[model samples]
Target chain A: MDDRLVTAGLHEPGLAVHVEDLTVSYHSKPVLWDIDFDIPPGVMAAIVGPNGAGKSTLIKSILDLVRPTAGHVTIHGLPYRDQRRKVGYVPQRSSVDWDFPTTALDVVTMGLYGQLGWLRRPGRKDKDRARAALARVGMEDYADRQISQLSGGQQQRVFIARALVQEADVYFLDEPMAGVDATTERTIVKILHGLRDAGKTVIVVHHDLQTVRTYFDWLVMLNVRVIAQGPVAETYTAENLRRAYGGQIALLDSAATLTPVD
Target chain B: MLDILSDFTLQNVMIGATLLGIISGVLGTFAVLRKQSLLGDTLSHAALPGICIGFLVAGTRSLPFILTGALLAGAAAALVVVFLTRTTRLKTDASLGIALSVFFALGIVLLTMIQNQGNAAQGGLDSFLFGQAAAILRSDLYVMGAITLTAVALVTGLWKEFKLISFDPSYARTLGLPVLALEVLLTTMIALAVVVGLQMVGVILMAAMIIAPAVAARQWTNKLGVMAALSALFGVVSGLVGSVISASATGLSTGPLIVLAASVIVVTSLVFAPETGLLPTALRVRRDKFSLKSRLVLGTIYRLAAEHGDPAYPAEQAMIDAFHRTDTSAVLSRLEQRGLVRSTAHHPEPTPHWVLTPKGLEQAQTPLDQSGETQ
Candidate 1:
């Protein structure tokens, strides 16, 4: 496998996520086509795109949640399956049934299931780690609260805490800011910044383009294909936004006013 | 009751029913949580054809052969639902409904064919439709017992994995768990649950055995472990009570009786369970309204006293009522009982008036912002 990755020139040591010729289709309807991008290690990145631009599909394809039709994704020079332990994921809040019978702490403890392996229950120490993760996300007080009883922002915080418990090297979050309160958005951004400062990769599927420049230093502008990818200062220009949003004049009019960082 | 317990046939019926209850209750928790409650109905109905096929193949109503056939048919029905939902535009309920009626029709056709075979040994074959608890044999207990043990053990060992998948399958896959395999295993477990109850509960009523206990249990707790345990307990109780009632009566079908018992538990839980019950919720709402009204009345009285520059000023009941646009007599009486207010006859008027006691003044003086902290 190492030889195959090396032969294909897919092994890039400094890139956190390496996608080469990735394409995905759902029943012959292409969602992502010939998408290629690389996010450098230790940078807080944003995958910005319009609705149906396959921002989620890109993240899911990289995580191997959705099988790509062609091409591959390597995380830190290894395939996702091999590097599963090093990756953390926060799927969309709508992806799960919130009314499920469980506590906040129990949901956070699920992150340890991957490490605990099969047929092994979570122990006291695992719960303590889960508690600590909850504390990091400011949800320690809600540890014993039922998930359905929490507010949208609190639920989003719980999800982040779950990923935090994974202690992974690369974190992929899908629209972590969608429908969340301002305070939760700040908390999530600060947490991502902390992860990046510790030399871990944090990639978020962000919707609010206004905060894209302020929150993320690395940007991958995608509309079914890679429009631009690099430092936010270089790639978050009005031209790239226009190309990505394409003919959605209402959104582009606002995008046209954003002054890209020098 | 003691005589019923001592009866040999009754003993076997009770034991078999109890075993069936335990497995169905445990596995049904997962089925209901996964929103596959109707899948139980589908699989149980689909098992009918398998029982008939087993009778034809063995030329006798052998319990093991019939149960094995039922298990296969139930599993096939599940696959059909999965295939239809995945390949076609049919939704899960639509596919489940289609599989259920189609397989049940085939089962009915086969059952009629078996009746026409003119075999004397097929006397009790029709009992699989609406179960006869008296037909439970001592040897059948071993089969039900084994299935119960296996299902319980699997649930205990794979508790977290099963929970994670039921709550979120995509997330489970991201964690490297064998999500698809676990799903298949869970579906098979539900099939086993249906198979175990085929003799005492029959195919038609077995779906209730799998769903009713779980539904009742959910109303009692928000924790999965507690819910599953309570569900199993409810199932066992319904089984024992249904079997006993049927054994004591003439021509009472144990299957329908057991289903009725489970339905009773469901209704009881929905109305009377402490946390999620309708009665408690309604009572709580009433309590909240009472407190809120009391606070408003106290605040109004306090304001009236302050405006009059007399701390002991009494507000007339009619005046207070006119301000709030509702009669405050009940609220004022409760407040008076709690020593927060007292009724006194005002001077120069025969009308009774309410005055806040010192305790009431202290409580009323507490800022509105602080009062909302209780909830």
Candidate 2:
């Protein structure tokens, strides 16, 4: 991990997603600073962090949703734009308008909208694919239901199904379990594991520290910078967690209104 | 009504109003769904200055020139909204309000100046404030129809793009969908929708045309395509109905009449439509409350019976009341009618003893089982 910390060039064939010297800022204040990591293919990895830790920023920068100050991201040994079709992204559910008059199927169909291109519409084949994706997430029964009518857990499942319809080699989920029920969390973890089993890389911006060892095989501890990266058993240590959280844990605990973590 | 068709002025007004309705209604769906209903209001208000500038430059009330000016002004207003929000700490709603008021204030000043000048050609320019549908000329109808057609064509050609951006622009951008371009396109279309209706609906009431039909239609459907179509239908109907009524009534401006009609439709839809309508939702809440009370009563009775080791042991009303805070007599009677519970005390007494029937006992176990399973 120390040797690979240097700015790696694009097309690192051994790595699924490679980011180096990735710094992102909102207006001049740096949100993510000098981030570096290489996620191996077929591993279920979690990007863990405290509040304002730039966990979401790291993923957004890698996905080109937010431009990095000075860095490059490669997906499967290629530039992200070149392999855009090979990647899938599920944003935070709260970031969208849930009352946008779309059904579960319609939202999932958007996963194929990129392939459908500019003027073309999704057809029966695309609908079937969306339906199958819904079934994969155990939400086939809700395919026709309006998105706003769905519960938080059901909404999360529909979002996952949408990403599933993309069928990319790698998937990025941003807080997929935030505000979700226990059943939903288990269902999502199972889906992530299924993706890993199918030889797909799954990256999630997760908050629950208790589920760290249980849910992910690999972990990246971030706090505007990469604290450590490797298998959860090795890199996710009490010392590293203290380094990443440390005094902030006390501050976070005091602010009980924020999501509590162990 | 027959006289209105025969009268060229009435005929022109009807056509213009109908076209504006359809265009605004179609575009308004995206506005409402995107949670940019306020943006529609802002853009329409911003178009006023454009209308004045068009009249000033052309020195005549040519529909095309006025509409072009309105379109440009409206687009500029949208840009200001984006610029203000991005550059400063002002949120979108605040920026929209600022832009709307500034542009509208400037427009009023220009309109006042134009009216003061008293040019013969500018006789009907003030009508743009509260549009005079009767003043709609044949040429104006052609212009309105053309604008409506362009709007329809653009929406049809870019249906997927619009839907994507409206629902989730960030995800669309991640997919390399050119989100900024799509956003600009939608803003421009909304501006265009506003500009085209600036004559018949008037700037003051134009936003309502854009939003009201969409709001009404949203109450009836969950599909974007259906919502758009239904909104268009509602818009068209409102326009026709408003124009007909206005033609019959003297001293009524068609713009406000059309807006009022659309508002009526929105109110009616919100109140009476199935599913999302207020009435049905209220009824469902009532029904659910009744059922919930019944479940509580039955569950309490089942518990009492279980404790006694006799399913048929009649539980006293005082005991059931202790478990439920609300009055339980209505629910008890409903349960008895359903044959789920029977009154052990045949006499009508305030403190009657009740016991669950076999069906009630079986059903009462569901809530308990559900609670256990949830854990």
Candidate 3:
């Protein structure tokens, strides 16, 4: 990874994702306001907040899926558009129609579409790579299964496999664990951990507060604005949770029991 | 059949209808999967205004001019729908409905004005309302053929891109696939299909031509490529058969007949297609119930034998029925057929009794945790 970064001849040791003064609104109603944060390379980070905290909006704005009213986002010291091939995104599972007539393998192959560019279909090698990714997520037997027929956990794995095939340096996942089973949740966390160990950064919009301390090493607590952002040990405190979740301090109090103070 | 084939008018009408079917079938798959079936209806109705504009401009009933106008009108209608949905709080259905009614009313006003002018060239212009297959000329076939071939080529070349957009547009955009441009291009292709079909199925029935074949094809396959191909085949069959039937009949219109043929295919596919169809699913449910009942009956007999401390203890039929609160006679017979149980007469008892066989006893000893399986 270091060699590739050096070969690209860009700046040295830049943040995996950097956002400055980002604001987003729908019809003049602000969802996120003047947000600023940076996620360094090779860490599994969680974006934790209550519902309607603009967690999804933050990810979308960073990935350039949604236009920001102010500020900009960069990946590896470059604008999102210029570094798109180096980034992979896993949107919420509910974002797609499960009943679409396609196999699991075909869905995973979509991750390669950006790199493949326009008008080039997935070939045998691309399919083999997709199959390998599916195997990594323990979905090799379900490669030919229709997506609609898969269980929710299996479907989540398929989405992860699709992201895995992207081979991107940074991965953004939106609510990957929502509504999935316990086994799938563990599998997804392990896979994200594996990527972080391999020197790839993973930023997830996570909802499970109880598992944050156990699952992630870095944390960004947000509530339409950045409450705190840093390593979990430094930031996952009772005070930060209260500030981020305002009026839901009771829920945070229970979750804070799992937090270990340094 | 030979005489029908030899007739040039019939031949031209059939060929034109076939071409129309192929294009609609191919393009409708995307529209239907995307849940934009109403978009086809709106576009077809909007084409009426285009037809009127074309007739007004050309001052003659030229197929190319009229179709080109229809295509443009349809595209405009699609844009209107998009604009309404994007700019205002109005939902997609409301936007489509508004576009359909407004554009169609405009078309009717233009059609009436043209009629009031007493132009002889406008003699057959009203045929676009409900298509007249017999009016198709060889030259019109050339135009339809070109449009059909072009649509097929575009779909073939951009199959993956189109499929991605149809299933998940946001994800497609994140992949940097130019989702907006692909959507516009796809909508234009559907409009082109509606235009090609306007003369044969008319504006009103053209939506059916697009939707019915694709809906039927979806029931038969779980792959998009197969569904599209099968949809095209179904469309072609409907076209050919409808044209022939209408040609043979005195008062039958080709448009309605084609729609009817396509509807028949849809109904058949919905009821009879394997795996996903209603009939097979219902049958499977019934078979599963019977197996479950049989297993329960066998288990009852085995439990009765075990409780009595006799491997061949005969459980009375009345006792089993009382325990289950339903007639176990039918289930007992099925179990007997499977050699899991046997009906016997216990000594000093007037009523018949049932006993489990060795195999049935063994089956009952296993846990009942498995679904849809007895042992």
Tell how far residue A191 is off in model 2, in angstroms: 2.1
What local lDDT score does residue A113 receive in model 1, on the 0 to 100 scale?
97
For model 3, give the RMSD to the true fold: 2.5
Query: What would the per-residue lDDT of candidate 1 be over residues B7-63, giving only the tens digit for each residue?
Result: 999889889888988999999999999999999999999999999998888988787
Worst-scoring 10-residue span by lDDT in model 2 chain B:
B366-375
Top-TM-score structure, candidate number: 1
Better of 2 and 3 by DockQ: 3
Deviating ranges (above 4 Å) for candidate 3: A1-13, A258-262, B369-375
**Candidate 3, which CAPRI tier?**
medium
How do the predictions measure up, each by TM-score?
A: 0.97, 0.87, 0.96
lDDT of 2 by residue, B1-375 (tens): 687667778888888888988899999998888889999899988888999999999989888788888888998998899999989989999999999999999999999999898788888887888777777778777777887899899999999889988888889977889888878888888888887787788888889998999999999988888999999999999999888888888878788889999999999999999988999999888887777777778888998899999999889887787778667888899989989999877355656899888988888887544633211
lDDT per residue for candidate 1 within A56-78, as digits (tens), equals 99999998888899998889987
Badly placed stretches (over 4 Å) of model 1 are A1-10, A258-262, B372-375
Model 3: how far residue B213 lies from native, Å: 0.8
Which CAPRI quality tier does the interface of model 2 achieve?
medium
Could you tell me the fnat of model 3?
0.82
Q: Ranking under lDDT, best-scoring first?
A: 1, 3, 2
- Rank by TM-score, highest first: 1, 3, 2
Q: What is the DockQ of each candidate?
A: 0.86, 0.67, 0.78
Candidate 3 local lDDT, B1-375, one digit each (tens): 788778999999889988998999999999999999999999999999999999889989988889999999999998899999989999999999999999999999999999999999899899999998888888888988998999999999999999989988888887888999988988898998988888898998999998999999999999999999999999999999999999888789999999999999999999999978999999889988888777777778888888889999999999999999999899888888878888999989999898888877877787777433723
